[model samples]
Target: MPTFTINGISATVPDGTTILAAAIRIGVEIPHYCYHPKLSIAGNCRMCLVEVEKFPKLQIACNTVVTEGMVVRTDTEKIRKAVTGVLELMLIHHPVDCPICDQAGECGLQNYYMKYGLHKSRYDLEDKVRKKKVQDIGGMIVLDAERCILCSRCIRFLREVSKTCEMEFFQRGDHSEISIFPGRKLDNYYTGNLADICPVGALTNKDFRFKCRVWFLSSFDSVCTGCANGCNVLADFKGDILYRLKPRRNDAVNQTWMCDFGRLEYRKANEARLLVPVLRENGKAAAAAWEGVLSTTALRLRDIADNEGPDAVAVIASPRSSNEELFLAKKLAAEVLKTENIGFTSRTPGDRTSDDFLIKGDKNPNSTGAQLLGITEEGFGRVVKAISDRKIRALLVFGSELSDFPDSQVEALLSNVPFVAQVGTNEGVVSRVANAVLPSASFAERGGTFTNFTGRVQRFSQGFPPRGKAMNEIEILAGLANRMGADWKFDGEASVFRALAASSAPFAGMSYESLGSEGQVVAEGRK
Candidate 1:
């Protein structure tokens, strides 16, 4: 440990911690733009200047590591003046477009300008640098050269993080601007990150352009359902409309970034979502209420179990579901419905390694969560074998587009099940085979937690209402279990999580409240 004084307050931190981080720890904020916690130190923006005792001049706090008995002052008059000067210099080339800019509300430049740049400009506004506008950087990102401060944050992000050196600074001096290599585009897996780190409106997301104003968009702490990595996120929405998705900081999971696929998954809610619960009775589909669906499904399940025994009833769980939902599905099969035939499905085929970056080979969100509950892909195969052997009659399937299976083995298993009850948001192969399809909420519309590949349990809250009358999968499962006259130990999603945490040795002391927005990683033996 190293002891240092930040703005007159003395404290001890890890040896390699930077001065800016120390200031943040002590609540003395130093304004910065290009210094991201997850990225390498760039020291390009002089906004983080701090006066150090015994040093000849002010040092960039982000690049300057704290040493034993080092003294740093960020709120001194000299430091503030230096930071103000840097801000003024940065704004000389920056366009005055905050009113129409996408990053106005949450931009680093805007925040820093208000905090450190209160002085009226003595520089001639007519002499400010002006360049091209609305230049397409790639499929998703659009660039406005006039608004760029040339901090080189985006350029450094592409080269260092994405390792895709597609972005570079072109030209020289006042004409220098961020551009891609000849004939290359910023079409990497994590290209959406540029929009998040732009500091200003120099780069904007084409998909999120002209959408709802960010201030009107309310945010919900959530997790990405796009992959098994389960990256933490904040879903921004207003009323029933979803606006955008932003990454929440989680050092154990995705760090400070999420994949483009996870970011664009919001558009999925705008189309083909099951808004209301529907029950097909006597070959006629009719709209139903929550009570009607649960009561009816419970009776039907009981009838099947009485006639065909527990072995004849099968339950299929989705990796897309939360740990609570999957655990409830299992309980419905083994306790309420009295069935041992349970299956867990995932879409990742055979790939399951982590790249140590954004893209995880496992495509589903909670495959490891299912594994924690003792449900594996191989366990699902046993159910398929039973279906093929004509031993299973009634099947309750969760998520996955069944139509994608056209002529596959899984399709054959589903087709053979006489009473196929499908519960999910999308209508696909399961819809074609099911006699009853209960509309369930998508990840965005529900509040739940998922365990990622690394056994890190994360929670995501509801961003918006379900499309129509759709119920959360956890709520639906719990409701059905209640209607079946079975004593369910849990009621709310958080309540069930206690049992999940208690039963699973890995997550022994974990709770929904403990997870909070940041989440916790399950240790080796504990997980």
Candidate 2:
């Protein structure tokens, strides 16, 4: 360990830890750009300058590695003056258009200006650098060279991680700017990551341009439903509308990046979200209140349970649901309905493993969590065989969106069941066969936890209220279990997780509070 003093606070960090990281650890805010934790250090932006004792010049904290007994001062007047001078120089060529810039409230420039900047400018009033309005950087990103701070974070990202090497610095000195070389363009599987690392309005997402101001937008931690890699994400919203998606840092999962496909899934929420519970009457869908829907749904299930016993009812859990929600579904089936034929459904391809990085083969967020709760491929096979026969009479299907399954096997299996109750965010094939249908909230509208491909459980809060009368899946399951006379005692997902960790073998030692940012995996040794 290397011992160092940052702003008079002594601390010990790993030998190679940078001064920026050490300063951050001791509550000193060092303004920085081009110093993303995941990306290689590009000491171009000199914004994280700090004064060190016995070292005359300002040091870039990002590239300055901590040494034994080193003393650093992050808040000295000399450091502030140097930082102010750098900010002024950077702002000279930068545009003063925060009103139109997409990165307004959260931009690195805004944060640095507030922390260390002169309220007045001292430039000789030379014409500022004027770049094209919005140069298309491939299909998904737009570039404005005038707004770029020459950080090279985007350029380095292209060269290093994505290995595309499309974006590069052009020319020399003040004429230098970020651009593609020759005929190549900034296009890659991980291109969206550059938009995140740009640190300014230089790179903007075309999908989120002018959609909503960042100040009005709120964020919620979530899991990417685009694939099985189960990348943890921040779902940014403006009131009831979803505006954008950003990758949340989870070292065990997707790390600091997400695919472009995952970023576009935010648009899906605005379309096809069921806002109310619909019951089929006279072969047409009709809206019904919660009291009416619950009573009718319970009566149908109770009659089936009484006549055909627990063997008659089956619950098909969705992998899109949370571990807490799925556990409640399993409990609803085995305990309340007393049916051993409970199974989870997904159109997951045969390969259900993970690569060295993100993108798990499972293709659903909580398959590991579901498997931990005792649901398995073989268990699903048993449910399929029983339903194929005339054994199971009723089915409760959750999250039946065809986009999730997109296969014929699940549809064929659902065809054999006589009576079905579909609880989901949309009306699908399951709802067509539904004797009673209830609207369940989407992942964005609910508070819950998901165990990603790494088997690390993470809790996400609801960013917006439930769409119309739709309830969270856990709440709906709790209500249904109560109606069916089950021993479900959970008041919410937290209680459900506590019970899950207590009784479930795999998660027996875990709790919700222990899950960290991006639902970092609980390391094997700590427990």
Candidate 3:
């Protein structure tokens, strides 16, 4: 351990810890750029200057390792002047268009200007060096050369992290700018991270360029359900609309980076949605009230199980649902529906290709949770065979899992099955095939936990309310369970998780309080 004094505060940190990191640990702020913890240090940005005792000149805090008994001063008059000078030099050639830049409220230059550099401009707009602006760089990113601060964070990220060396510095000194090399452009699925690492408006996301201001959007900690990797994210929304999902730092999962596919998954909560419950009438589907839908659904399932047999009913749970929701679904099938013939569909309905970085090939976030809750993935074919044989008197399907089946086969099963009910988030094949369609909430509209591919259980909160007459899976399942003569009660997701922890052996002793922002991995040593 290295003990040091920073701004008159004594602190001890691990060996090789930088002054900037030590300051951050002790609740001190040292302004910096181009010094991301994940990327290699480029020491070009001298904004984190600090005064070390017995040293003639100030040193940059980012690359300055703290030695034992070393004295550091970050809040001195000398540091303030040095930082101000560095900020002025960086801003001399930068554009003054913060009003139009999409990174307005969150830009590093805009924030540092208010803190350090308020000096009157010594050079006018015409006197500053000019560079290219609004160059359409490949991979959903727009580049403005005039606003780049020559930080080289984006350039280094490509060379080191993504291993796709497409961007580089063009000229020398003030005329230098970031650009893709000739005859090549960014063609990777991880290009969206370039905008996140850039400290200024040089690289902006084309999908979210002018949509909404950062000040108007509120952020909530969430886990991405795009795949089994379960990358952490910050859901940015306003009112009932989710604008974006930015990567949240989780060292065990996605460390401050997510693929482009996961970034756009938020659109499912905002567009082409199902709003109300629809009941089949005279071979036609019609929008109906929740009360009638629940009662009718319960009556049909109960009468069939009592008449034909427990094996006459089948359930197709979804891996896209949460742990609590899946537990309730399994309970609804075993206790109320009284059938061991319950399973979830294994084949997903997306681009199943994955990379070595952050994406997973399963394309489902909760398959591990579904399996832990006693739902088999191999029974989809058996359930389909039962429906084909006309032995399934009543069928319950969650999500649009049937949509991934062959259209001719799906239609034949829907026609042969006596009664079909679906709980879906959006209108797709289920709207046409199922005899009754119940609207359920998307991932962003409900709060629950999802177990990733490695058996790591993470918690995500609801960012949007259920649109129109839609309800979450827990509420809808509980309603049907009670209507079917099964006594069930749950206050919220917390209570449901508590119930899940008690019943499931793998998730024996865990709660929402224990699984805070960063989640706890399931399996061994989880007390």
Pairs in clash, predicted candidate 3: none
Among the numbered candidates, top TM-score falls to: 3
Among these predicted structures, which one has the highest lDDT? 3
**lDDT tens digits, residue span 199-310, model 1:** 8888999889878778888888888878888888888888887778878888877788888878987776666777777777665777777677777777878888888788
Ranked by lDDT, top first: 3, 1, 2
Q: Per model, how many backbone clashes are there? A: 3, 1, 0
Q: What alpha-carbon RMSD in Å does predicted model 3 have with respect to the real structure?
A: 1.6
Q: Which wins on lDDT, candidate 1 or candidate 2?
A: 1
Compared with the true structure, what per-residue lDDT tens digits does model 3 show for residues 121-203? 88888888888888888887989989999889999889888898899999897888889898887978888899998899999
If scored against the real structure, what TM-score would every candidate get? Answer: 0.92, 0.91, 0.97
**Per-model CA lDDT versus the true structure:** 0.80, 0.78, 0.87
- What candidate 2 gets wrong by more than 4 Å, as runs, is 119-126, 348-356, 385-391, 402-416, 518-527
Q: What is the lDDT of residue 111 in candidate 3?
A: 93
lDDT of 3 at 277: 89
Candidate 1 lDDT for residue 140? 79
Measured over all alpha carbons after superposition, the RMSD of each candidate to the real structure, in angstroms, is 2.8, 3.1, 1.6
| Model 2 whole-model lDDT (C-alpha atoms) | 0.78
